[model samples]
Target chain A: MLAKSFNIHIDNQDLLDEAFTQASYVNEHKGQNLKFYERLEFLGDAVLQLIVSSYIFQRYPKMPQGRLTRLRAAMVNEKSFSTFARECTFDKYIRLGRGEEKAGARNRDSLLCDIFESFVGAVYLDQGQATVEKFVQQVIFPKLDEGMFAEFFDHKTELQELAQADGPVDIDYELIDEFGPDNDRSFKVNVSIGDKLFGVGIGHSKKAAEQRAAQQALTHFDTEGDNLV
Target chain B: MLAKSFNIHIDNQDLLDEAFTQASYVNEHKGQNLKFYERLEFLGDAVLQLIVSSYIFQRYPKMPQGRLTRLRAAMVNEKSFSTFARECTFDKYIRLGRGEEKAGARNRDSLLCDIFESFVGAVYLDQGQATVEKFVQQVIFPKLDEGMFAEFFDHKTELQELAQADGPVDIDYELIDEFGPDNDRSFKVNVSIGDKLFGVGIGHSKKAAEQRAAQQALTHFDTEGDNLV
Candidate 1:
């Protein structure tokens, strides 16, 4: 049953086995978990900390450690887990028992969070941090965006996805630099869809800068995007 | 002067003066700071990444990423920032110029950790991750033990400081026994004052469990000391 639950994506028997082991569910379901996500969660736990730590370190420049700690706690709590779980479509694929499903465990915040944690543990075991960080950075921190307010993140990602889509759309990002040592210079980024700039964003990463700029475009286009699927 | 050198913790006035801005000193001496620790580290773009994403999801028994992330990163990067800083005495009673020193700037870890990063930036801000982690864990992590290693980090502290005044004495720590689950085990420690049990110490804290055991005993005994200062 545990093995069957983990039968999504990768077909590597070893990965499936390790994923079961890390979750510590193999034997309870049948007899043995060749591997479990426990150790990987340990690894993932460390990975998650650094990702958020680095992000907070960058995002909230003068927010101070106290606020940073609280913000981190809020972002990585059950709420973030559930948010990421939906983004990853984890609830659809998790291996739960008749009992859990019958109990409506799918939407349970704790369960959702657990799956994400186990997911981290499994991924860390399967591919290591470099691989895992992508998943975290792409999925997790965006949860923070949602936390600041839910609608904002969806709007933001939509704009970013639209802008980053290389098919056949013209996107422009312009910056009016800030006053500072050019070495540590800051800038305000404005992103455009066609002519009039849609929105403005600021950040250190051209990616983050772009994301912020895209977010502004998103907000500006919110009315146009009201019925987006 | 004061405000500018929030990052500098020199005991020498000339050095403090050189590190300060006349405006910096005025701002700091007056007790305000837009500056903080790790500004330079952030400036250098020394971002730490999670090696993995939220894996515990979709993996096994279903733990969430939220709790998982916090536990995993307890020492992930900046845990390196913590425990070690305290141990090394990086900024314990730090000395600043009379201008900045009296503002209680010397006792700030945020300031301390910042200076620590600046010092790193000063030395090799552009160094490799391995070099950076090594310098921090070795140089800084051990420093996290300062309080842990405080008045009697070892028998040497007992001997050197106490022996000098009260003739001679032997100090020893015995584990006595270990208890609890391996991951969250508790340690029972006893410090011997010449074959007599000085006091007992216990902790559920991680890292240097054995040393912490000894450390707890030393601290408790020191507070209840039946001897002279």
Candidate 2:
């Protein structure tokens, strides 16, 4: 299914093989066999942050740190990554054992999304940020808005640069609470520096929630007409 | 006051003036003004982890991640850092603004703690990890037990490494509310990560309350706060 969706011919069987192999599977396959996507995942994770940082920066030239951070959450979130896996046919390419395959591992969004990270890493080192951005636009940005991206890149980094000359400051975060049931709790967060509390945001989950808080912080800074308390 | 703390035999007033100047500060200011401590603080944040990791790796060959993490936290925490700063008289040499100086910034436990980070950074760069560990022992570990240091370094960095890895995980944190009279209300927090629920912690204030929650989360992951959940 994934093969037909992307229509990219699989010229390299080894890359696909590595992507599907779990650490357990690799161990059984042989001590002599290939290195898998774990390393790729690490590289991809770093690459993911860089690309997202770049995208948010360009999109939100004036947004504050907190807001931009919130928007970044909207962009580079896990749930969205899972959705992208289905769209890209990344699900089909993932390799799993008989037990996992029988359990619908290939159809599993989480598994497929992790592989996308490996793929992103591969794409990043292969072509650098420009091409990575293109890959992201084609694969990931369909559901994301430029506005959200702009908001998330909120000048936190900018604030950071500006604030450093003044003095050393700490980024203080306080997690307020989670609401609703176990699976569907919303999180509230507040971010502060010095005596200033700049952002407050809520998310369906904790990371998302923190991102929301970061986003709020950014927006607060950009609209610095009223001094944040 | 800071100058009064240290008695140095100066050959000439001109020499002292030159040493205080930024250009000449490099030549005779000892470790002062050569390179500010911030960069090292940045690197030390990670390098401290690497040191602790290796320390744990050798000490208890059979220990798992959780215990090691808790141990690390106890070692590097505010209380420990405060003591380290006191032992080294770290505040006496710090450069601060007139206001910060007048406000008794040197006596503030937190500021003293930050200086230890700067000192660690300085040591790490000047002599490397080996020297830094030695410095940690010589300066900070006198009152602390060997078992504590061993425990602290073992699992010390895991939680921070993990919670920070994918961002904050979804925590089902319930702010049960402010009980007692409005004048003396206490906040209660029960934070859960997945099926694991932390024991409730209380605070007299809301910000303090939330910090208690974060601290609960910290303890749940063991002191170093690895990604067990």
Candidate 3:
């Protein structure tokens, strides 16, 4: 499928299969000598980071480190990767266990994101870094150039601007709750604008939760008849 | 310096200077057309991640994603990168403002780490990814192979083992205090072994503080007459 679409010929079909395989599938079929996508996801993540970083580095020679970091994060994050996977029709190619398939894992954002990374990893192994970079430039950079990723980087600032335009409104993001183990904690946050709760959000980290809250607030303003600016 | 050490010819010397120049130096010499290391650091960070990730991926084919992530973090972290910079004698090459130089910024871990990333970025631009990977393998992978980074990854686990060796003593890492602004907060942690405070540590994050506390506790055991096991 990748070859047909992207013209990236995989030298080893086994690597491609490994990239598509989910852990659940491997775990369920215990006797099968199947490799899952986790390892590939790990490598692909680094490959993606390097490609995006290089692209932006050369594209915007004067852009500062902090902004570049934020931009790279915006491009490579779960939401963006999942979107890319969907655009590539990865849902059609992903292999899942019966249980996972029943649970709609094929359409899951996290799973899709993982698959994208794993695919990149497979490509890296099969064709090398140049091929991987070319694939990224051809497939991903177009979306980036179209400003599809700008919202991911600017949600908080945009929310702030929208709030302040109404004249000195107190916008506060309060962490209402946190749960799970220390290594993997989810935080719930509420965004309040001038004593009124505008929106609520939940995320893996505090900053993520705050950003989501701001995004929610912006969405709330958009849904209403209120002009954002 | 890098060219002489690595035997790779640099196409642009100005880029090398830019990679060494701190933002403070650029700001101080406002009239001069100077570039800081931050941009290069951004690109180099990704380059470093890719190289390290690829190295470990090939070296430990069967390692799990969680462990791989932890190992990569240990290798690419500020402490590790700063150590690499020191090993390469980057302190002598880095350019800092007079005020920053007076404040001993040359030896600062954060600055050193940033400079190393910037250096890698410059090398990538000057020579390319293959050369950058070769440089990393030559300079950094030897230390990784020697298990110099084992302490960074295994501090908590080592501390746990040490504590549990003497009939399952309760080990607690308590967050005593957190301060500074939301973006850059510092956490102070105390590691208590069986109701006695063994060590105290401070870091930019809670997890880092806890790790440092464990490291300190381990060091205390090592230095004192008390046997860790």
Best by the lDDT measure:
3
The top-ranked prediction according to DockQ is 3
- Expressed as tens digits, the lDDT of each residue in B1-229 for candidate 2 is 2224322233343322322222222434465524333333434444454454445434543343345445556666677777767876665666555666677876888766656665554444445556666655455445444443533333223334446566766556578877999888899877665567754668898656655665666665423333222
Q: Give the per-residue lDDT of model 3 (tens digit) for A1-229.
A: 7778888999899999999999888878887888899989999999999999888777766555655677788888899899999999988988899999999999999999999999999999989988998889878999865878756346687677668866888889899999999999999999999899988989998889997888788876532212211
Candidate 2 per-residue lDDT over residues A1-229, each given as its tens digit? 4345443334455655665555545545665565456544544654565456545444544443444455556766666677776677677666555677777767676676677776765554445546656667777665554333343344445445444546888876689777888887788887787778877878896667666665566554424321211
Model 3: residues >4 Å from true position, as ranges? A152-229, B152-229
Candidate with the larger lDDT of 1 and 3? 3
TM-score of chain B of 3: 0.67
Q: After best superposition, candidate 3 residue A22: deviation in angstroms?
A: 0.7
Candidate 3 docking band: medium
Model 3, B1-229: lDDT tens digits are 6668888778898999999999789889887888888889888999999899998888877766766787788889899899989999999988888999999999999999999999999999988989998898888899865878766346788678657766888899999999999899999999999899988889998889998888789875532211211
Best candidate per TM-score, number? Answer: 3
Task: Pick out the ten consecutive residues of candidate 1 chain A with the lowest summed lDDT.
Answer: A220-229
User: Model 1 segments beyond 4 Å from truth?
Assistant: A1-24, A34-36, A59-67, A97-102, A141-229, B1-26, B29-34, B38-83, B86-89, B92-100, B103-128, B136-229
| Per-residue lDDT over B75-103 for candidate 1, one digit per residue giving the tens place of the 0 to 100 score | 33443444344554556524354656677
DockQ for the candidates, in order = 0.07, 0.02, 0.65
